[model samples]
Target: MLATVARPSPESDPFSPPGIALEASALMGLRHLARRGTGATTRGRSGLPGGLVTRRRGRGTEPDDVRPWAEGDDVRHIDRNATARTGTLHVRTHHEERDRAVVLLADFRPSMLFGTRRALRSVAAAEALVLLGWRIAGDGGRVGLCVAGAEPLALPPRGAGRGMAALCQGLARGHAGALAAPLHDDPPLSPILEQARALLPAGGHLVLASALDSPGDDFSERLAALAERISVSLILVSDAFERIAPPGLYPYATPDGRRGTARISGRARPAPEDRLAACARLGLACLRLDTETGPEGFAPLMERLDAVL
Candidate 1:
């Protein structure tokens, strides 16, 4: 029987960001292990082919690969087969198989920092990156990360314990560095989108964590274009309270770094649902993580999604 998926609701949702969760250093470690998806779609109902299901190497370690021993290499894990194949001892390097590849596009615009709840959208992005990397790495799948800040950075996918550490560290660093820059500006998505398209291999999945507040509308169009090349998952982070805030006299700041004031006398209009619907029409899996919820709230949703992908 098919399992039912729960519909999203204000009361039922759990994906929220705490005020402070992921520190900068941890993000740097994550960056090293990050890689782009191959843009490959998942298989249909037929399931994986024969011989693909192999035993796992062990906890927190990947399978092995034999290579010729270098001068200063560790001799403890030398393989006998390679010693026989060649006339000398060869080091056995255990490299895990990457069954699935995930690319995280973390967006850290200024708008993401505007939240009314316990945490900002930026916190949600960081948490998602860390949790996703840990879970994916634990499963022996290759994980990669991409940052769409005022500056762009891409971490290639890797399948080793060392690689995972590097990925985490990189993401942590990116998060810290991103905070120092101005968030509002029109960035050309063509180069980054092209890079994303080229990096994602076939059957790979792409996860974009952003607030969708770009002014030029270019990023959204580029995202839609990328979806055609890969299995795209859109994680839109927002604060429910801010999304529905009532209009009143409030202090405000303009995007150009100026203080301003505006009179909002009534309720703000709800964002058009059609924008999200169009994303669905493009075959993108759209998920919203409201900042008002709580940190670690989206872990269950991600766990459930890990299976479906």
Candidate 2:
């Protein structure tokens, strides 16, 4: 059984730093995006008797209704009895067989607290979560989340209701809390992945957003196992500086007033590209979001995400 964190009390601190926040306007924007058809139909191989659940209409066990056939209606779905009786083409439509679980694994470790150009990495992650959550909810699917920080938080999958609202609020609180809380040993991605696997129903979709800079040795094995069971995608959140550090001596100090100076040799970093390649090698779809560019820069990427989910 996975240990679950109790939902935190709503923060009353108006002074909370401008980090990741869940705003109504942003969520509304996502609603508009969904209306514009950003939410992709779900598709994946789950090895189950039935494949992935999708919104697309298809031949299902349960009979829905018979209606006049349209030009694009599948010929196989034509009701022979109705067609003969009415001397007009008629077709059978079925309700969606099932609702798919959409789980978001958001990383809120201390490393996500830093950003140079746009917003903190944590903020970007939160925005991405909100976008995905709303997109799935708008598509009439369930949404859930697993937040990894000092203390991990999990909300089981639910439809667009109070559950989704709680999830949005929880995401904002989790990211904000991470900034003010003391540092601790960050939880490993493997265990979180395990919990997510347990939470998601078969054929469900999982979206993981993180810097993914320090996934432990067991990460690959666990990811591969999870991928075999369900659809898995990765959103690699990174700062421009991480990919190409400026050439100069930089000084930094901790909150405790400990100061240090470091030299940046302008060496090119391959970690970002390497991470993308690794996802490809594992057969996991990956999206890279740079903090400097923000999410708006990835219109094509968002479309790809829609098609995959």
Q: What lDDT score belongs to each candidate, Candidate 1 first? A: 0.57, 0.68
TM-score of each: 0.64, 0.76
Q: Candidate 2 residues 171-282, lDDT tens each?
A: 7667656755654555578988888777888668888988885667789898988888888989888777777776898665433234567688865445877888988688
How many clashes show up per model? Answer: 50, 2
Model 1 regions more than 4 Å off: 1-99, 186-190, 252-258, 265-274
Worst 10 residues of 1 by lDDT: 37-46
lDDT of 1 by residue, 205-298 (tens): 7777766665245666776677777777777676665467676766654323455556766544335355466667778877677766653466
Off by over 4 Å in 2: 1-30, 33-59, 62-96, 255-257, 266-269, 298-300
lDDT of 1 at 252: 54
Q: lDDT of model 1 at residue 222?
A: 74
TM-score computed on alpha carbons, candidate 2: 0.76
Best by lDDT: 2
Cα deviation at 109, candidate 2, in Å, is 1.0
